[model samples]
Target: MIELQMYINGEWKESSNHEKRPIVNPANGEVIAYAPEGTIKDAREAIDVARKTFDEGIWSDLPAVERASYLFKIAGKIEENQEELTRLETLDNGKTLREAGYDILDAAACFRYYAGLITKPDGQTYHVADPMQAMVVREPIGVCGLIVPWNYPLLMSVWKIAPALAAGNTIVFKPSEITPVTPKKLFEIMDEVGIPKGVANMVFGAGPVVGHEIAASSKVDMVSFTGGTKTGKHIMKMAADTMKKVSLELGGKSPNIIFADSDLETSVDYALFGIYSGAGQVCSAGSRILVEESVYDEFVNQFVERANEIKVGPGNDPDSEMGPLVSQQHLEKVLKYIEIGQQEGAKIAAGGNRIVSNGLETGYFVEPTVFVDVQQDMRIVQEEIFGPVVVIQKFKDEEEAIKLANDTDYGLAGAVFTNDGAKALRVIKKLRAGITWINAYHPTYNEAPWGGYKQSGIGRSLGTFGLEEFQEIKQININLQVEPIGWFANKNE
Candidate 1:
């Protein structure tokens, strides 16, 4: 267990109120850290620091290449401390060390990728009404409010921060109350690297208090939020009061379509790992596994077997493949969903009971659950559980598969597994999702754009798309180069 201090105004300080929340390890239900509990007052101070830093034009005025260099430094430092970060994440949030460890690497990669992108330093240059006088520029959108979730805390933090920083926007970030240690460590690392004061400030508080403050803040130019869809809607409404630009990566009810002709082995492997991995807490979890009717039973049998085979325990244990949920509330929520599945007449193929009752002392651990014969409109199939639970439904043809796959308010991510190129491409084209995997799942990269079409999200988060979200484009008019192409605004042409 670690005691973490708040990082604000380029230094570590105790909150004015000096309140602290005990972050418990879900794997063992033990206190892992005493994290600061910040108030709305602290959130305002953090925003002030960010706004002042942006107005000062220290980082924003810097050359893109130089900004990129700083990103590299951060990445290098993260790589150097990967082991410590992995352990911290596992202890703080109840994820396996291996998954959290790789997340650190991915976080470093995101920063490095965004860093390289900012060096381009150009926006628009093309034929205009006045071709010779045409101009283009980019301006930073001042202070950003980054509200991150407990799952994948560090990686998600970097996802919000790196690109915003690369685009020259200072940030007042709020980490979820459950997992506050990683962000503190990240802030400490940034301070060690000499990132300017107010460039990055953090407040530790929950959704209603701290999260709402960031969303409703007039000082913040933009809000980048990742969380449940309902909360995201609340955030959108809150930010709307001030007309702040917002990028929301919300919940998903994504599908995984496995054709009968596909390579069943590889497809099932990624299919199982996709939803079951991370204890099925991923936003992109292929929760709805839509298989061809021919191989549906076989696939379910294998999937259920594989799912039941997983060994669950404390995240610190190297042998533990799955750990506990983040808290008791979440555990109960997942179990309630299991009850919903049974009530909806969906068949539970394997384990559906709680698993932590044995040797586990205090963590929130539940058995991996798989459901079959699920109706398309069942509540369990419709809502996101955010746990190690998956719903399996069958489709007779490609049309049915595509139909079932597209039947959701959330269009975040989906997958189509088939060896036939035509079938795969057909399904890929038909599946209306943000990121559709041809034969894989959860394979997002820093270079590829990641966003949703409908309720899944607002703007892209990674690749060039993520970096540009914080940049406001401006057209520069310079008559020094040439004359106007057409007399639209000026008679001088």
Candidate 2:
């Protein structure tokens, strides 16, 4: 097995305590690699170096365009090593190689997109009446702490890192301990691109030790995290002590509404794509399917037929449609939920068991599952399974659909499928989510704002909004003409 070291202060080294953890490939339960088990001290070292790098202005004080150049170089390196990176990501995360390829390309595009954006110099100038002028300038918030989740590991890391770096901030990033291979490879490319020493660093460890240290540290200026809602809330409370800036992209149980007027084939295909594409591991998975009562039976039939056709196996296999869960613990969690769904009276229309056949006995594989006759309040529908499972329900009308879709704590993402233009707009407006789709699902872009409402998350993470998350705005007001008028006379008078 390959052993990986933590990247800190322009050096690849072991943790302060010299501890290590194994990285398992979920596909076959193989210990493919090992990473440093970083401690609070290691996290502190990363934060301190990042703090010093920002204070020294080695990177943050450079011209915006100059910073963009470094990002461009990083993007180029991703494309050049796409094949190797893709393999590593799939081996680490157990996502299909094709899906990993898409993530790698998207990651590269994100850096390139930020490269172009930083060139614009996101600042504004205004001319007030007469002799007064005002300028609004955006400057980097120093020593940012970025914590990303295990799913889509590299893509999510770049989503946070690209914008933060483009805005001229130094970073101390912590990828999830479950999947650290690709992020390590990414730092290799960052090193090759000659990123200034201490400008960017990576730590490997659990959230309680390394993660909380970064969030609570006084030296860190901001914390951007993408993970579970409970964890996000804990980070928020921790950061409250220092009053550090925070941006979170948290969990979701997004709704996918299908009206009777929608195209059945297209809607069915999109519904499957939204939930099972990543084995339903996505935070924004449309796990709740609310179909119009008139066509509920027909849609469920089609959805189940398609769900059974999905081939689950190792991610390295080019023909496998879905791969294993990230770990055995997660597999058990999903199986328990399936048992709970049965007890709650939700019918298992498709699959409800683990896949241990077809030479896949060792891997943590789960068959694509679909639950029907599911009520809105059922645990399977209300909670995020984060597995290859989905629940289907029937809605009577537009008002009921909207009400059902909004009847959850999460308001991250939702989808509406209907041919009626006016109805699509009207329903989309009523759905309580940051990202809504019409006749489609799970297609996010680089130029649009991506985030959620309510308990879903606190702030946006992509496009111009993402860059602003790592920045602080300053308003500069000046009087062109020298003025002597004052409310109070001089102290001498």
Candidate 3:
């Protein structure tokens, strides 16, 4: 099995405690690799290194063009190793190779986007009423702690890393312990690109240990995390001790509102793609689908028909349309949610059991599931199952559709599928979400701002806003004329 080491302070080192955790391939329950299990001390050492690096200005003092050059080279290296990275991602995270390939491409694009963006003029000069000049300048926020989720390991890491590095912030990264393979490869690429020592470091371990240190340490100037809402809240509390900046991209139970006027076949296809992609482990998965009363029955029937056709198999299999869940523990969680859906009196309209046949029994596989007659208050509809399960609810009119979509505490993402452009626009305007799509489901762009309105997240990621998250804005004022007015009466006067 492949053995991985933690990248800390420019050194590839094992955990100080010499502990290792088996990295399992969820596809077949095989140990694919072993990763260093970092301890609190390892985490502290990385943080200290990052703090010193930021203080010394080894990277933060570099010119923007020089920083952009590093980002460009990192992007190039990622492109050069695309194929191997894709395979490693699939093996580590149990996603289809095609999906992993898309993530790899996007990660490269993210780095390139930030590289170009950083070279552009960012600060603003303002005209003042007095004879003084005023301007705002952006500077790095010292050391940053970046924590990413397991579902989109490399892509999520890039989402935080690209912008943070572009803004010239030193960082201590912590990837989910369950999926450390691709992240290790990413660190290798960064090292090969010759990033300055301590400018970027990574620790591998459980969240309560490594992640906690990153969040709680005073040396960390900011923490950006993408994970469950509950965990995001805990990070916020921990970061509060140091009064550090925090950006979160958290959980979602987003709605996909389908009106009768929508293209039926296309809507059905996107609906399936919306929930079943990544086996519904996506943070912004359309788990709650709201359909107009006129077409509720038709949409439900067509959606179930398509969900049943999705080929559930291993990520490496060429014919597999949908891969297994990320891990056996996650599989059990998904299964339990399915049972909860039934217990809450929602009708199971499609596959809901674990798939165990055709040599797939060893894998953590679950058939794509659908639920009907689901009420808004039911646990199945309100909570994020984070699996290949979706609930369909009927709406009487446009007003009801808006009400149903806004009912959730999560405001991460939502979509409206309809033929009438005006109606689609009108409904989307009312959605209490950060990311909204008209006639589309899951097409995210690096140029667009991403996050939520409410509990879905705090602040945003991607686009220009993403870079600002790692920066501190400062105002500078200068007197054009040297002479100062004697406002205060002097003793001689």
Candidate 4:
């Protein structure tokens, strides 16, 4: 098994407690690696290193173009190691190899996207009245504390890392203790690329210790977190003490509305892809599907038929269309939600049990589950299962569809599929989500902003907005006419 250590101050070091935790492969329940179980002390040290690095202007003082150059190099390195990284991500995250490959490509592209964005003319000059000149420039927000979730380990880390580094901020990053392998590999790449000392530090441990320290620390100027809503709320409270800038991308019970006018086959296919991809571990998983009532029965039948056909197996299996959940704990959580749906009087229209055949008993595999006849008030309909468990609701008309779709606490993402372009536009516009698609689901671009309108998130990521999250804006006002006119004294004289 591979042994991983924390990256701090440009060196790989053991945790202050000298304790290591086993990193398990969810596919086969094997201990694939060991990661340092960092303590609050180690977290404080990493934060201090990042703070000193930023305060010393070692990285933050670099020219914007110079910072872009480093990001470009890092992107090149990621592409160079794409295959290996993909394999490790699959092994660590328990996602299909194909999905992991996509993440690797996207991670590289994210770095390149930010690299190009940083060199562009970002400051704005205002046309002020007469002898006054005004402009706004963006600067790095000192040391950043970045916490990423376990689902998209490498890509999510890159989503925060690339932009933060591109904006010239040193960071103390914390990847989920559950899936630390690929992120550890990423830190190795940073070391090889010669990232300046203390510019980017990584700590590995439970969220309560390392994550808490990072969010609550006074030295960290900003905290960017992507995880469950509960944890995001906790981080907000923690950052509130120091008044640190906080950006959160939290949970979503996003909706995918399929109308009768849409291509039935394509809508069914995408509906399956929406929730089943990544085993529905995605934060923006379209777990809530609202169907036009006229076509609801037919769509439900076809969806169940296809969802049953999905090949569930280990990530290494080439034929596996969907892999296991990230861990046994998560598997249990998904199964528990499935049980809750049944207990809440929702009918199971598709697979709802664990996959134990074909020598997959040891792996954390659950069948793609679908529940029908679910009410908007049901817990399964409202809560984010974060697994391959979806609830399909029926709505009578366009108005009802929109109402059902927006009935959740989350407003992260939504989509409408219909042949009527005008109707699609109208419905999509009404979605209270940050990301909406007319006839698509789960396709996101690095060039566009990604976040939610409500509790789904507080700030956007992955575009120009993503870079600005780590930056502080300053307005500069200058008086071109320097001569001062005395109003009161001259009048008295």
lDDT by residue (432-464, candidate 4, tens digit) is 999988778899999999899788989999899
lDDT of model 4, residue 51: 92
- TM-score-wise, the better of 1 and 4 is 4
- Ten consecutive residues with minimal summed lDDT in candidate 2? 121-130
Q: Which order, best to worst by lDDT?
A: 3, 2, 4, 1
Off by over 4 Å in 3: none
What's the lDDT for candidate 2?
0.94
Reference-based lDDT, each prediction:
0.87, 0.94, 0.94, 0.93
TM-score against truth, every candidate: 0.96, 0.99, 0.99, 0.98
Q: How does model 3 score by TM-score?
A: 0.99
In angstroms, the error of model 4 at 83 is: 0.9
Q: Number of the top candidate by lDDT?
A: 3
Model 4 global lDDT (CA atoms, 0 to 1)? 0.93
Error of 3 at 432 (Å): 0.4
* Model 1 pairs whose backbones collide: 28-363, 29-363, 135-476, 136-476
lDDT of 1: 0.87
Which residues of candidate 1, in runs, are more than 4 Å off? Answer: 129-131, 481-493
Per-residue lDDT for 45-67 in model 2, tens only? 99999999999999988998899
Off by over 4 Å in 2: 490-493
